[model samples]
Target: MILTRAEELCRERGVQFTALRREVLEAVAASEPPPGAYDIAERLSRPGRRVAPVSVYRALDFLMELGLVHRIASRNAFVPCAHAHGIGENVVFLICRTCGGIDETTSPEVESGLGKTLKRAGFTPAHSILEVEGDCGACRDKARGAG
Candidate 1:
């Protein structure tokens, strides 16, 4: 379903979703904790085929442009967007500092408040990405157990 959505988006944008792009996107989606370009390239490499770092970076750029993937700046890694076609919506990522886990969510109230504030400040936002770094519930529970 994700791949199909990506294909549809590419068609709508008049961009070709080449095989390398698809593979790179798949590699990003398959990772639990978003991965960097080098990690993606390493994953794509196999017994007979080798995926170059440059190719992965190029594909990542294309996927990000299409809103099929998002780069977590703090982690320098890329993760697949949950709502790929809903690019207009604001996304917030909750990143677990201890376990490197990420939870993606959206809240209209948050977006509205931020939008209003930005508008008042004469700032026209291109994209809004909120990343909160903290310990996840499981990590907290594990800490409690160990203590």
Candidate 2:
């Protein structure tokens, strides 16, 4: 699960991370594509078991603080961050429009490059998206074949 490290973190921080929290974390990590809160709530609510939307949302918020997950503002969805426990300023996600795939990569070079521009403008940057939308390799190949 993505929350393996998060669980360890909870232990270190003396926070009570519950089984429901782990379930919610795993639900996101297990999705072929990242799942929205509604989707996750539906999954958890199937048949005999259930978790409310508020419960799911609360768990998601807690997970976000722990850096176990990331919310995609463009899609209104969430996914497990690649570096669940890594020590970095912020992780950037490159989202693919065609295939709905997400690639998580760090950019020290980008940080330095953009940092220079921000400093020049006298504006200090705190957070950024760095999300680019484009066709992934598989989708590009498919498009080539179709054409």
Candidate 3:
């Protein structure tokens, strides 16, 4: 994940960064996969930051609302939002069951299709997340016992 020019963003939003918040954001930025609250707590503890799980969770909530994060529902984890400023477009996530890898993509076709279906059903989508599960190549190879 790439961070914005910190000075620029902070200036724009009048946002102040605390040490713990910075650490948490950096950890999330550096995570190979999206991290759950527990995962974040563990990492924070390892660094001797002494940040509590609840605190980390609260920080995550703030970051998400700030448009700096995205949650992967299937994994119950959070990832840095690719779009830093824009409210994210609806995304479809391909999640790997074995290795926990995730790939996010957008599909207007899917959005319109689902919207039309929901409209017909007398429902409107205020929010949506479409997650597809499968084994990633590495995990598939691991199960097959191939080096």
Relative to the true structure, how large is the alpha-carbon lDDT of every model?
Answer: 0.88, 0.82, 0.75
Among all candidates shown, the one with the greatest lDDT = 1
* Poorly placed runs, candidate 3 (over 4 Å): 5-10, 46-48, 137-147
lDDT of 3 by residue, 29-91 (tens): 778777788888888895544678999988787677666777887779877765544564687
lDDT assessment of candidate 1? 0.88
Among all windows of ten consecutive residues in candidate 2, which has the lowest summed lDDT? 83-92
User: TM-score for each prediction?
Assistant: 0.88, 0.88, 0.80
For model 2, which pairs clash?
A: none
lDDT of 1 by residue, 1-147 (tens): 789999988888899999999999998889977889999999999999999999999998888877888889888999998875466568889899998988888888898899899999999898767899999899999999999
| Candidate 3 to truth, TM | 0.80
139 Cα displacement, candidate 1 (Å)? 2.3
What does candidate 2's lDDT look like per residue over 1-147, in tens digits?
456687788998898899889889999988867889989998888778778989999999988887788888888889888874454365668787887888787878888888889999999776777676677788889999999
How many residue pairs clash in all the candidates, one count each?
0, 0, 0
Candidate 2 residue runs with Cα over 4 Å from true position: 84-88
Q: Judge candidate 3 at residue 28 and give its lDDT.
A: 83
